[model samples]
Target: MIGDEVQVAFTKYDGSPHWHIGTRLLGEDEHGTWLHSPAGTFTWRPGLAFTYDRANVLCVPRGQHWAATLYDGGGASAVTTYVDITTPAVWSAGRVTMSDLDLDVVQRVGEEPFVDDEDEFELHRVRYAYPPELQAQARAASAAVLAAVTARQAPFDGATAARWLALAEPAWTPVAPPARPAG
Candidate 1:
């Protein structure tokens, strides 16, 4: 139906990011589209007087005040295009610098040492950044592990949820246990 809600993954085309604005179609006159951030719902008309339609869509950060037309492809199938009001976007890496923080001088079990510069605090650094899909997959695995641990009545609870979650991802696994010498 025109009012159905769906999760559309944001796509980057030519560098700019866009969101599909929509609202639930109420009647023959009503149409739905989504917002870039998707804060809530909005409605439009069928006469093209407004900028929404069953076939219409809005481009993110580019297309200005113009209507959208969603070309239906027979039962939940359609190709959508919109007027380009803004220039194509360019992808640039965010300025993230890692400063190595030397935690070697720590003398306590739970004490965090200080670094001279704010940007120099890099006690932890990621090996590599994972894609969105991979991050989601990791989260799913972690959730499954927590569920299993809970089911087994492990001596843990919400207080230790973070620790348990961290354990979900195995950093390393031993191939075999060390053999014990016979007496």
Candidate 2:
């Protein structure tokens, strides 16, 4: 439902926790389900946590193996967009979870978009014992996302994200970083 809070979680291929963040459901379109993580949203992993200094929109395309995060521009960080090649998202009880494939497509301001984290992907492939089919699927998803983002394709293009961002701004509530959980 639009305006509802949702938890987004990512796990490694070996099922280790990766990133987990809280976001607001920003409605869906032909592209996919859109989520808004406004500035100050808390994102954390096993040993790291931080608050976002800029707003971003997350798109998890239906039946797609990739998810994209579109950032607000003009920040010190050059990253304008980041796409994670992952297993298709599974939603349950107001949460969405997916397995991060360790491959990413990044678009930086004033630079050509490129696939990042090949080394990490290769390392995890061995460590996690990814099956041949899974490896091939991850590679294919990376390639497809790279092309779409590079070509400014719909949902990859800032326009679609911008519209969603605007809708979220009015209802945005500030989020503080959560206290680190005790070991």
Q: What is the TM-score of each candidate against the true structure?
A: 0.17, 0.94
Q: What does the lDDT read for residue 178 in candidate 2?
A: 37
For model 2, residues 55-131, the per-residue Cα lDDT tens digits are: 89999988889989999864567888999999999998778899999999999988999999999999999999999
- For model 1 the TM-score comes to 0.17
lDDT score of residue 85 within candidate 1: 16
Best by TM-score: 2
lDDT of each: 0.24, 0.87
Clashing pairs in 2: none
What digit string (tens of lDDT, one per residue) describes model 1 on residues 59-132?
22221212222222222322222222111222123111111121111111223221122222121113323345
